[model samples]
Target: MSTTTAPPQPALPIRGFAEFLGTALLVIAGVGTAVAAPDTGTLGIAMAFGLALLVLAYTLGPVSGCHVNPAVTLGLLVARRIEPAAAGVYVVAQLLGGLAGAGVVLAFRSGDPSFDLSADGLGANGWGAASTGGYGLSSAIVVELVLTALLVLVVLSATARQSNAAVAGLPIGFTLVVAHLVAIPVDGTSVNPARSFGPAVLTGGTALEQLWVFIVVPLVGGVLGALVYRVLRGSDSDAASQDTPDPTTRAGS
Candidate 1:
């Protein structure tokens, strides 16, 4: 008997689109919830982000590993799980996707006669008075760094080859929920730079001024998380090779 093999896939573009769409959906669902329902509180916002990620992980994970976040991409890059060029492309896609999602939210808000992008803010992250709990700059930096680092660590572990791919989404999503729950009051919880960038670009003023904190801290945290993972699991390449599978393959197959 003879068996047919599947054709090779165009790895980059498909993966890139998956990242783009996944990230856009994440912002739309997560930030959209916050904009539409300001009274949802921390748990509601956390659940919004978590559920969005969980669904995206299962839906797009097969195509792009559903990174949807630059910090996560950077974490994989530092771990050597992805090549530099691919990681760059993923980051670009994620940023553009975030912008697109925020634009959609902006459009929706325009429907309201009282909506003000600058004053209302599109769920942009910040410190001090902008922070939900008025946490200071140092507090914001430390909280984002630690939470983002932990989030990336969860991503690295959940997607490892030794992990059960079938169930990775649950833990990864739950970790995001926990991160938001802990850091929402501090700096609105930006473990993802793209997520922070979208609203800042739209809101301007202080959000734009404080944007650096979200971007730099999350990136640093991502690298730290990858390094910590390397320490715990040994060489990244070896572990990644042992568990990582071809992107063309169906997830959980």
Candidate 2:
């Protein structure tokens, strides 16, 4: 019997769309929750972000590795797991997706008579006056850098082995939850640049002005996280040598 092999699917556009949709859903759940229900408090908002990503990971992981966050995409890129061109596409898609999701939230929110864009910030991230806990610039920087690194590290490590693929989303999603739990009161937990960009662009003012912090710091954090992953994972040759086993050992010893 002869079997015919199927042609490989085009990766860029399809994967990019998956990333777009996944990121959009993430913003819709996380930012939307923050905007719609400020009363639910920090844990509710954190869970919103985490649960959305958990579902998106399983839904879009096969298509695009479900890197809905640009920081996560950058971590994969630094690890050399993704080509530069593909990574660019993924980032662009994610930014546009975030904007789209925020637009959706704004559209419905505007209908509310009491919703004032200026008075009620649309879940944009920042420090100082914009911060929920009145955190300073330095505090914002450290929180973003550290928590983003932690988030990127979890994403990198959990997805390292194919055997772990079945549940990689668990740790990744949980890490985001923990990051938010810690940073929500500090600077609204912008481990995700795109997530911050969406609401900031629409809401304007401080969130928009301070957008650079959310963007630049998280990217640096991603690179740092990737490099740490490299150290802990060791070289590919080292992994291979370890897998070869020691022939000098007696069989069934």
The reply for model 2, stretches above 4 Å from the true place, is: 1-10, 236-253
- Tens digits of per-residue lDDT, candidate 1, 1-253, equal 1133323445799888988898888999889988888799999999999999989888987787788989888888888777799889989999999999998988898899998776888999999889889889999899888988898888777777634577888888999999989988988888999999898898899999999999999999999998898888886545464456633221110
TM-score of 2: 0.90
TM-score of 1: 0.92
lDDT agreement with native, every candidate: 0.82, 0.79
lDDT for position 249 in model 2: 7
Model 2, clash count?
0
What is residue 144's positional error in candidate 2, in angstroms?
A: 0.7
Candidate 1: list runs displaced more than 4 Å: 1-10, 247-253
- What range of 10 consecutive residues in model 2 has the weakest lDDT sum? 244-253
Candidate achieving the largest TM-score: 1
Model 1: weakest 10-residue lDDT segment is 244-253
- Residue 137 CA error for candidate 1 (Å)? 0.5
Q: Please tell me which predicted candidate would have the highest lDDT against the true structure.
A: 1
